[model samples]
Target: MRLEQITYFLSVAEHGNITAAAKSLYISQPALSKQITLLEQEVGLPLFERQARGVVLTQAGVQFQKDLQNILKELEHAKKNAVLAGRAQKPLLNIGCFDGSYADDFLPSVYDYLKEAASGQKLVIHKCNFLEGHEYLEKGKIDLWLTLAPSWQDRPGFLKKKIAWRKGALIYSEKLQVGKKENPTWEDFKDETCVLVKKSQNPGMFQHTLDTMELIRLDEGTIEVVENIGTQISYVKLGRGYCFLSENIIHGSKGLRCISLPGERGIEVVAVWSEKNAAVTNLMENYPI
Candidate 1:
């Protein structure tokens, strides 16, 4: 009728004596005998034949013991598998990247580091624009964000760490020879069209570009905003404009010449997440910049 009754019945059946079975179960012989009597009454069959020396199993009792042993074995198997399944369910680490191009340079190293450092955990990645990444982080869709340090980095409830600084550079067409100098300042491209991605895609980078342009005293209409990176690169390759990009992004491209920006003012690439994420905190602490 109950699991404890079944267990008690099995123990009595195994020992062939109520006194020995009660000793094994750490209970009184009368208590063990009472449980077996209750089990026999529930099953509506006599489970034992009384003898002076001990007890012998009735025909029904032998069959019942065989069936109960199989049932107990299955219960044990299920419990073990449940424990194994719990262990196999690894913690997920969802990471956000600003763009596919950023992932191309950044994710491989990060994936490798996490694979070794946080073994048995799952890793998931999403590539989206900076604003979308920020939204994902705020809404709990992503656990970490990799992007340029934004204006809100120092705000409360967020944690931001600078992992690396990528130097800024100008990507211009080879045909447009603005200067023979290997490294040029923003002043060198005063007359050139400054093609840029949409400000909404990356407001922080856009503000930085605006600040640099202001420092050079460039005219207001000199900047051109495009919808995407491919369009910006196309404009530069056609000698129609030049664009500011991190050196890491434009490296090894064939048609464009990358001239470094002056003063070594590099863009800070950061890892950001909510301060409430203990997993993110552990990751930052383990993998320090």
Candidate 2:
């Protein structure tokens, strides 16, 4: 199938509705549907089972989606490698990190280690969200991933080490007064609702939230769940509920009060990398993480 057909198919699968997918992609619904039809004809299989409300992936569609995702990641790596080779740049090590300074303390030392020891090696940082970074690490697009733990992203052939630890952030509406304490406990949040991002969007963060809440003895009387960060933050701004985020990224915003939520189970900044990298020995040897 053509690349555009593949892209359209993925969007339709993600939205689970042709019309919604078309709107999201800024294309006409008829055009998108025609592409899907052509793709299905070429594949000789129905990818999605049509439904009254929307559509659902058939078993074959699920497998195809997973395979296509990996193929795309590998394709990206191939493109980057060709360009880097053409430029005759230094040997590259791609580092994927969550978009924040949480892991900044450990990076300077890593930089020093590379500068003093492996001077020929080049380091490139890819700032990404949890899912993007996780996907990059899995696909070998990145040599390393720095993120918050406990990482629920358990997979074989990958190694993880705790690089550092920090407090988590409590996000709430500025109008609400939980107390004057520097760090607010779950007791202060007992009467209010807690907002959570959908587990499917960020499984690691979802599991971490549950784990941290359990550790801090949260007694949430109400709960609201949203699809993503933007919607989650909207709920908080509307005073619907409070949520927790990574410490380093959560400086209080215009309408939100983001503060330390330190407790027994605090944030663990972690470094995850594939076990098969050439520089694995040097990385593991020179640094604790």
Candidate 3:
């Protein structure tokens, strides 16, 4: 079977709908359906039970999907190795990460280490939402995922290696138009507007901090959906409101103060990948916290 066909099948299996898979693949629904039909005929079994809402994998389809995943992963590994051997500039590893200073802090060192180890390899960073990063990893769309804890739920065949731990820090500009301190506790900011980075960053860790301290009545529009670290910092700097960030962000900022969240269980950063990637084992050992 063709690799493109296999890719289309897997995408449909992952998304459980032809339309979603078509959108993801940047192809039309009719073409995707025709390919799926061709694949099913070649396999000599009805792999999916078609339904009005979406297709469900038949028993055979479920089994085939798993086997197909294994085969595709092996092929991808082979391709990566061949690409590494032939590249002129540098062997590359595409890494996905959450946007912010977290990536800025860790990626530089990681890149340095990989370059030193490979003698000439280059590491490329693709900033993505935490959930989307994991999804891409599962789909073989990325080589690595570096993200905060709680962005993931257990999935078969995936592995995560914890790298660094940092408490969420409440941060605000010293010259902000409101708020009492450089760093306010969850309680202090609970009543005022609070800007946040993204839902993928996992706000639950801070939820307990707010609840335990009896901090309530978070104002409407308090939650600003920031796209990146720079945006969050800009919001705080512009006196828009406050935000919670990794301690790394406030580490050396001239006027930024970082207050530890009450109690521990602070966020942990982890490097995640599929176990099938041969590079993962070696890279895991070399990952810099």
Which has the greatest TM-score?
2
lDDT of 1 by residue, 8-124 (tens): 989888999889999999999998888888888988999998899888899999999999997896586457545655666887677877664644666677677777777767776
* Candidate 2 C-alpha lDDT tens digits along 95-130: 777664445656777666656576676766677767
- How does candidate 3 score on lDDT? 0.72
C-alpha positional error of residue 47 in candidate 3 after TM-score superposition, expressed in Å: 37
**Which scores better on lDDT, 1 or 2?**
1
Q: 20 in model 2: Cα distance from truth in Å?
A: 14
Candidate 3 lDDT over 101-123, as tens digits, reads 65776777666776676665666
Candidates arranged by lDDT, highest first:
1, 2, 3
The clash count of every prediction, one per candidate, is 0, 0, 0
lDDT of 2 at 2: 76
Tell me how candidate 1 scores on lDDT: 0.76
TM, every model: 0.62, 0.66, 0.58
Candidate closest to the true structure, highest lDDT: 1
